[model samples]
Target chain A: MFQFKYPENFLRALGKPLVVFISRVGELSEFIARALYSCVTPPFYPRLLLKQIINIGFYSLPVVALTTLFAGMVIALQTHAGFSSYGAESAIATVVLISVTRELAPAFAGLMVAGRIGAAMAAEIGTMRVTEQIDALSTLSTDPYKYLVAPRLLAGVIVLPLLVVIGDIIGIFGGYLVAVYQLDFNPANYINATVNELQLIDITTGVIKAAVFGFVIALMGCYNGYKSKGGAQGVGEATTNAVVTSSILILILNYVITGLIFTE
Target chain B: MNQENNKIEVSELYKAFGRKRVLNGVNLSLKKGESLVVIGGSGTGKSVLIKCIQGLIEPDKGSIKIDGFETVGTPRKDCEKYYATMGMLFQGGALFDSLSVWENVAFGLIENQKMPKKQAKEKAIEVLRQVGLGADVADLSPSEISGGMQKRVGLARAIATKPEVIFFDEPTTGLDPIMADVINDLIISSVKKLGAAALTITHDMASARKIADKIAMLYQGKIIWQGTVEEMDKSDNPYVRQFISGSAKGPIKVEI
Candidate 1:
């Protein structure tokens, strides 16, 4: 009587990844829940919140402005090329404005901030975890979630929308420059077309997406960093994982939100 | 020290990380105003035991009671009372890099006790003075300080709150002999001044001998030997002898 050892091994192999994935999802959800809970609780640190806002918002302005400006300019040039073939060159301003406000600015700004702020949060918290500073905080009667994670999450939610709003303005300005001087479109016509086509719903959709993306970025960064172990290599891995996971989540959420908001 | 009133009581403690059991059935008790040092080689779970008491790492099974209040599995809000009564000096100082020395020392006071900043700073400075650090060093960041000074600052932070109990994790691990002695002296004086119960875990024989009123040796996830310093010197246990003598040839196998 032969036992089905091969089938048993196959089942075990197949179940391993499934088990790991389920557990990872469970842990991530728990982390996000705790972070959100801490945000509303007491023992709030205004100083830390202010510091993170400055770090994540004020310092990020230049980079966000540059990325969206270039993105807007490129979008105008490309739309001019594509639409000109269809004899729709006058649509360049409308396309650039809608794309910048409803898509490019928010998405680009989210990805950029994820790369910058997400990695920094991960590295800082991972170091704290490895060095036992996080534990030290607990032993000192301070909750690490209340002290560290809450501030970052709040700052991210508040500041990303502001950055995206600024990005939208700069991006539109960039498109204007390219449309007028480079493409030789009449300046007055371009401005009128942009203003006529822009809608409150378009700007609101981007702002809402930016807010969600910001929360995801900070959540991933803090979760990965807090759980990091094994010293320097662990911290490095957490930093990489923070940026990767946040960027992917931002893109995925952007599509999901867009579908919800714009679906006919 | 009155044995009837135990400051901390740990019983049947068990902790494991994925199949590697770090602590098994560890039982120890410290009386009020007593100093107990747990000595063991690296990888012996000394740090894990302290962390369990501090509620930093939850043990798989254990009962840790402080002043007769059970701490294991207590809600964080309820545990704050226990945390406020205890102080810990981490193995690597573990100072917040973002904060200055004074800010670090005053952290518990400012954050937990809700003390005003100016008063907290004055208390921090007073604690620094107790640790033989000057007022000038208070404003400097931890990274700017020497390792010895950092250790002293860590001690200052630990004692600044005037807690009833203190835990020192490798207080003199990374220091010169003189600096180690200085730390040992500071630890002794701070405990005496506060009349606090102290629990220190270290592999340094000299530090352990100097700081402990009672001594315990941990091996293979259990306390293999425990006695007073004088009793420790005269103990006939092979594990204790081999450990105290720093001999490689013994019942305790060197992993290498």
Candidate 2:
């Protein structure tokens, strides 16, 4: 095996990508640190911050609403089917309430906003980067991190929890409509069961998860966009990367946040 | 040559991306209120040189003294005071698509100097008119405007702050010759009106001839020659002659 053999390019190829990936992670960490520092610095842009809140929160409502609503209804139907096999249909209300508040609402909202808002942020900032608008911002004596990244991070961290709260209510309502109207459960009794089992921890944990997810989405979008180069193709790649990375991060973080907060 | 008389003095500048050096020992000085134009072939690091001075691209080695204060390797916050008195007109206009045209023009005034919105709007309109744009165009988004008009708006934004020094990056590249001339005239007038020292980088020979009071030719990361436009016409250096003459045959080789 040791007989005068040159190593193939296989290790070189694999090592190159590995090194690039590690460097990319390090760059992203530095970018996030700068963004967070800009967030706390003075000369805050209230106009830009308000605009992003409306963008990330208000504009994202219909999509998040529709996603969570359908999610709740689907879970309601599925739980009724499974529990009814044991004549335990009465447990459906508890299942719907706990699942919607503790998991489904926040996860769906995060994914929905990641797809809608994250991609848009990447495309917008990516275009600005290639077009020299970000450079233009700097020559005007405005810090690009403060002007572009901080408002977005602040808006995401502040607004996503509010969005998740809305999603939680609408999602529970969706489950309620299914249980009372279609499944022949008593409206008053189903409401009683859902409300009785709604622990404060479920809602609080979901909100906390929503904030973390929001930060991830904004960070991925801004970071990808900021580093974009070349032309329209580069911006297209950034948009795709923003959505894909943020969605994966949301799912992975969902498990971690759930395990950390819900465990004894 | 007096230090206090110069607005910007860049000495022994060197920059490289990986193994490919873009600038090597670039020595240039702009006296206050003087117009110096750098001309070079495309991809010859003309833009990179300007960016290095703007502090947008950090040069590997250089001393860039803006108003006699060293800027190279200085912390960004410390450089902000230097940048505040400077303005740049980007080649693409680089107008903020998010804001209306007037907002784009007034951005620096309102955001950096903290001017009141109403006052800034008035100032924006005034600057727009100075750039040969009508006040009606103020409310329109930059995307709605034509390229020539965007350049005007870019010029308007550049001068809006009454910056002491101005940098123009390819101010006339994408426009037709006639529109290019009009922009050249406007650039001359704007620089004159502001009494601002101007540094422009362009490959357009006609634009360089029209806008430059003094010209410098950059080739392969060095200023091969520098002199007045008349001196450029008489330059015996084959590189400068080949560039100004637009000849494919000479010491300069075309990759294509």
Best by TM-score: 1
Candidate 2 structure quality by residue, lDDT tens digits, B84-169: 88899999999999999999999999998899999999999999999899999999999999999999999999999999999999
Clashes in model 1: which pairs? none
Q: Please identify model 1 stretches exceeding 4 Å from their true place.
A: A1-11, B1-4
Model 1, span A169-229: residue lDDT tens? 9999999999999999899999999999999987998899999999999998999999999
| DockQ, all models | 0.87, 0.90
- TM-score per prediction, in order, is 0.97, 0.96
Could you tell me the TM-score of candidate 2?
Answer: 0.96
CA displacement after TM-score superposition, residue A163 of candidate 1 (Å): 0.3
Q: Report backbone clashes per prediction.
A: 0, 0
DockQ value for model 2: 0.90
Candidate 2 stretches with Cα past 4 Å from truth are: A1-14
